[model samples]
Target: MISKDPRKGGLAGRVTKLSNSEQQNNPLHGVRLDAILEELVAKLGWEELGKKINIRCFNYDPSIKSSLAFLRKTPWAREKVEQLYLRTTKKGRK
Candidate 1:
């Protein structure tokens, strides 16, 4: 049942609340793509990232700007990068 009044938390308000709650358990919730790339590069370096994800952006003439552009345009590559980040962060915590 959706509330009619926005002040009383309508559909949009409910969605916002749900989204905020869901993000609490999500590793990438508050992380930006550039920040993710920076962390991965700092921890793994471009060579290892290239080897792990096999993306040309990382393997050939890698720069944060180039990588961010490519990843933003390419969904599959972005997913790989995000997955690698989640894995790396989890490992670091242990």
Candidate 2:
């Protein structure tokens, strides 16, 4: 029997991970989730990052561990974070 839990693979019972070739051009390909969270926290602080993302993990009693757990299971939220990271870093390069 397959689990209906999203954390347990969701209704599909599995998730597809992108292959190396597929992520080759991605700036966040090799970036670890923890590192992303850490950098965002460092650069934006929980208050600003929370305001930007509007996520509970960043808004209330935020911590790297809690945020990581939430973001790992939540793809959309993770994507938002990665996009924010890219945008924030891009500005620094100029």
Candidate 3:
């Protein structure tokens, strides 16, 4: 007999298939922004990097979508983010 619990992973398999549709279309498969940000933050303290960058998204409540949108239009801000990313990674190696 099938289980009747609504939360028993009823749609996960179907949702996973739907989610993977976009990945199949992209050459870069599963590149995710959160993973990148997490690595950056792990290496660099939130305050150190956030203040240096000075973008509202990074300084205040940061979201991947907002940060991406803000960075796309602001070259300087994007540069800061990239630079911070590099610095954080480099520091982590030492």
Candidate 4:
């Protein structure tokens, strides 16, 4: 049965709708974590990334697979990486 109220579908439906709306506004929406790492490495190199983000994965012994694993588990580090990507690319776009 269809509900007249949007919230009547409950939490899952509301979360899905919120997610879709957020995706529309997020530049990193459809972008993969690996892709973001790859682009950052390509543009900045491991040394620079480590300098900027100060993460052990990028500093000590970097590999795309390892970095991806670390970033996936570490939200703060992942957010730093995404912010760097956005900041760097935004300037280049101009």
Candidate 5:
């Protein structure tokens, strides 16, 4: 049965997909993995994030090369950084 609504399923669910505006907020999207780490290090600072999160990457003067390698392999650390980014951005609004 053909639906009358033209918008029924034509990329309807894709609306939530990455838009250009949102793409700006995503540090990792379309970015080199090493670059993402560099930005995180620059913005958050390794010492501060290390103090807060107690992760090895932030603790040991870790390089973008090593951190990128670790984060790519470890889902849990990636999740932690994503969560931190969300929290940090949310706080910046106030």
Candidate 6:
């Protein structure tokens, strides 16, 4: 069946992808990984973040440049950082 929404002119159920505006609801949306790292380090500190995420980049000689390089190549680590960013920001607001 065709989608009633003109933005999605094709079949409705065929794909359930979110558009850019819809994705703004995501906490990480439009947030750069480097920015996320800086915030985490500022809020949690590298030692604490390493304890939480258990990654060498955060544990030893941690720097945003190095951490970002690692996170970019490693999906699992990047996901961890994004999750922590969301959690940290939520707590900050409350």
Specify the highest-lDDT model's number.
Answer: 2
Residue ranges of candidate 4 with Cα displaced over 4 Å: 1-19, 91-94
TM-score of each: 0.74, 0.74, 0.47, 0.75, 0.55, 0.73
Model 1, span 1-94: residue lDDT tens: 1235656554542322345666676667768999999999999999999999998899999999999999989878998999889889873353
Give each prediction's root-mean-square deviation over alpha carbons. 7.1, 5.6, 12.6, 6.6, 8.7, 7.5
Best by TM-score: 4
Q: Which ten residues in a row have the lowest lDDT in candidate 1?
A: 9-18
Against the unseen true structure, what C-alpha lDDT does each candidate score? 0.83, 0.83, 0.61, 0.82, 0.67, 0.81
Better of 5 and 6 by lDDT: 6
Clashing pairs in 5: none
The superposed Cα distance between candidate 2 and the true structure at residue 77, in angstroms, equals: 0.6
Across 9-88, the per-residue lDDT of candidate 2 in tens digits comes to 65866456776787775777678889888988998999999999999999889999999999989889998998898888
Clash counts per candidate, in order, are: 0, 0, 0, 0, 0, 0
Provide the clash count, candidate 5: 0
Candidate 1: stretches off by over 4 Å: 1-18, 91-94
After superposition on all CA atoms, how large is the RMSD of candidate 5? 8.7
User: Which tens-of-lDDT digit does each residue in 10-46 have in candidate 5?
Assistant: 4332334666887776655564556546666788888
Q: Which digits, one per residue and each the tens of the lDDT, describe model 4 over residues 1-74?
A: 11245555453322223457666777877689898899999999999999999988999989999999999888
- Locate the minimum summed-lDDT window of 10 residues in model 5: 9-18
Question: Which 10 consecutive residues of model 6 have the lowest summed lDDT?
Answer: 1-10
